[model samples]
Target chain A: MREKSGSRVSLRAMALLLCALIGASPVVAQELTTSLVDIHQGSPLSDRARGLGNGGYELQSGNRVSFNQWYRASWVDMHVDLLTQITEDAGILWGFGTGEQGEKYRIEPSLKLGFLTQMHPSPNSTLSLSLTTTIGGKLTEKSCQADYGDLGTYSVNCRLAASQMAPEETLKYLVNAKPESQHLWLNYRVTF
Target chain B: MPARHLKFGIATAFAMLSAPIASAQEAPDADEMAALCHGGLSICVSATIPAARTQAATTPGWMSPDVGAAWAAGYKGKGATITIVDDFSSTSRFSGNFGIGVQTQRHGEWTREEASMIAPLATIRSKDFTTSSSVTLAPGLNVLNLSYGMYATAGYSPNQIGWSAEEASIISYATRGSAIVSKAAGNDSVAVGGVTNGQQDYLDLALVGKASAIFVGALSTNGTTTNKAQLAWYSNYAGSNPLVQSHFLVVGVDGSKTDLYGTSFAAPIISGYAAIIGSKFTKATPTQITNDLLNTARTDTLVNYNASVYGKGEASLSRALAPVAIR
Candidate 1:
């Protein structure tokens, strides 16, 4: 009789534990795996090809920027720019982080805003840099045919200084040198 | 006190009545497909893929010259029908190969010519479904050869959102006695660790739809002469980060044979072998057949070796057919 009572008590304890575990799981979900904001900065162009003469092209591209010439090659900025992170408490956070950026191209003409990340991040808020390689945007217009001889092997020419789009919008903006244009930049983002 | 005992009895009866009801709600019955060959038997071949593609052979089907020889050796996959499932060209209709009439127009034809090469006297039924579609799999189909991978339209992320829906139906056919063989893809993605597709790890967290799938990966074409069986450069590997390591098998894909690229090519070889094996063991379930085949695979000399990559090693067709003779 004593053993039977003991077994019954143990069964009740097991059931209670199971119930408690199921109930407590919701709380676990609330625990932050990573921080909300780590850092955001303009990264280098991954596949941007610098005119390495002799028919050979040097690929260089940007990370933290949006551009129209996704199907075309991107160029490197001649000036020095510092990109940094905005952190709360310094610790490692992982998972996906989203942020926005605004860019005014000195020569290129375009407006852009979007999120960027390489892959899923650890469930924590960390800051790091990552680089991404991608193909340029496609050219569909006959005017593009006249400007760029071939649809392939073209580059994003940032030398075109822009004030505003013409009233007719004849010139389809290709690459935007602004950070907002970067849809998803591959980078080695450091979280600290 | 008497009322409490009455309550307990009622509870026990209620529990018994609810058990089957819950099961019925949880898992419904599976579909039934008509058998294709005689008494619904088949030959299940699991060969390294140099046998099928025309480019690989001097006269086509050269890698497994032994297979045709086996047929000539009086080991006809006779009285058996084989169903091959692959992303073949729209016109190469399987009928040109399997020697059977179009059982259903929904899929392509399996020509008797190919059937003559494997089993001279068997009826063949071929079914082809676009990789994206969730088609119902049937039993008694003798042998079902899936010579393709979980192909997603290019540019799409490898997410399991659409695949989960069809898991139950696929699992049902596998549970029943259906000779089904799927190529373990040719891409050499190591399945030992979590296979990162593009950039995400594929996890089989939900066991809702998984059978002992006969997944066959690829090896170099040099035959058994090579010491190590490196996972073909494109075959995706299986491992446990989301879970544990449970990948597929790898057979030969060497020689002058060029059709040895994707698991898509390797699947049919196993399907052909399964047809041959099924001919011998007339009453084996698809699950049992997969087990016996895997159990009979050759051991490799690689380290940290587990079933994730070299599943039961390379498939030995003769041994699987003549299990009792050599063992």
Candidate 2:
């Protein structure tokens, strides 16, 4: 776990949520000229490697103990966006997103720059076309913690008395516990 | 005969039944499989880390209830001490190519490793018994692990000779002192009661007399399914007497990082558990700790779930350390 970096992300996300809730009043909303909505979504493009392995033994108290195990996880994600104007004939469309990958969800930060073209076939109907591409986003590799102190339950097997469950069973328990990708919506609609 | 004389008598008779003691078979050590990270753990030893968190992270069940989850929760057996009494040597003592099993440095080191891996902070001492007449408990030792046991020769039961005088002395000392003795149920399949299928083990009546002593049996998991593990085919489990049933316990001895196996490995697991439990309930007596472990064990982990084979069930660190509630 990236203690410093992860905490920073958590703080920023909390701050963003706090700001969203504060300015949500209708009176404050009407004063703003821009009516904008941003949406993002993603999942893995391929299967993730289980990435579990064990080294042999080390001396502890002058005795040999099992070497710890290792684990890694990677996933593909997808997100999208839609835009429209309230009072202007010319409209602007934009999309920006990120992917969650590697051990700590190394944020695949990407900024999308796009232009929208509007075609008015008649007074009653209008069609719009937009194209956007993201930049500076890539997946990072995640492996099990190399250090025992950092591994938590990852380093030990779960036991009921002397009889214990398998090593991966405990690992799966830990992996299953971690939060999956968040803040990405596959489909979206705005209500007025 | 007096208690001391009788204790010596048991030792003499045990020696008479044996000469060069029958060697524990050189079965391929299964513990190496544990190094493969068998029990569903996601972590393994890397080519990194300081001297070692001692692989305490990966050996969750054998060392800690949840793979050092107890340590993270801050209940490592810091103040407790475990005394291992066996015909084991403290040092390797050999050059290369010595394929030693239980008879030499390999066994003792493996047992010590298992206990230390679980309770790294606890003190572990090997009081060798190769030439000694009787085992002694160190002043502060809270747990004594006896991973060796007498053989059942000529198809005879354990009662033919009360018990080994050396072991009996240790058990007697444990009974009167603050220490608890962890004994290995022998390898013979001798049944505790009338079960014909038995391994030559500690199915003797002498073991029942010591309230402070516990007989440990080896266990093995059958598959990935939860609670699929069962008593190792060779582990002894005779429950003809009440104390045997009350004092008996089973722990897993699957392949460990170092290729060790048998009840030899099992005894130390309980020893480690005892130390860990003792660390949490510093005020609890050795009897209290022993009883709590027996009382709180998880029988569900047994495949057949029979008290005759599993004793009171597998020892559970979490249950023993959990707070005792009042109405």
lDDT score at residue B149, model 2, on the 0-100 scale: 51
RMSD of 1: 33.0
lDDT of 1 by residue, A1-192 (tens): 011222334433433343354332212221222223333322222111121110111111101111232223333322121111112221111222122221212222222212222232564444333322222221121122111111112222221101011111212232222122233333444456
Q: Measured by TM-score, how close is model 2 to the native structure?
A: 0.47
lDDT values, one for every candidate: 0.33, 0.47
Residue B44 Cα positional deviation in candidate 1, in Å, after optimal superposition: 37
lDDT of 2 at B166: 64
Off by over 4 Å in 1: A1-192, B1-69, B88-123, B131-141, B151-160, B163-168, B175-179, B186-188, B192-209, B225-229, B238-247, B300-306, B324-327
For model 1 chain B, the run of ten residues with the poorest summed lDDT: B19-28
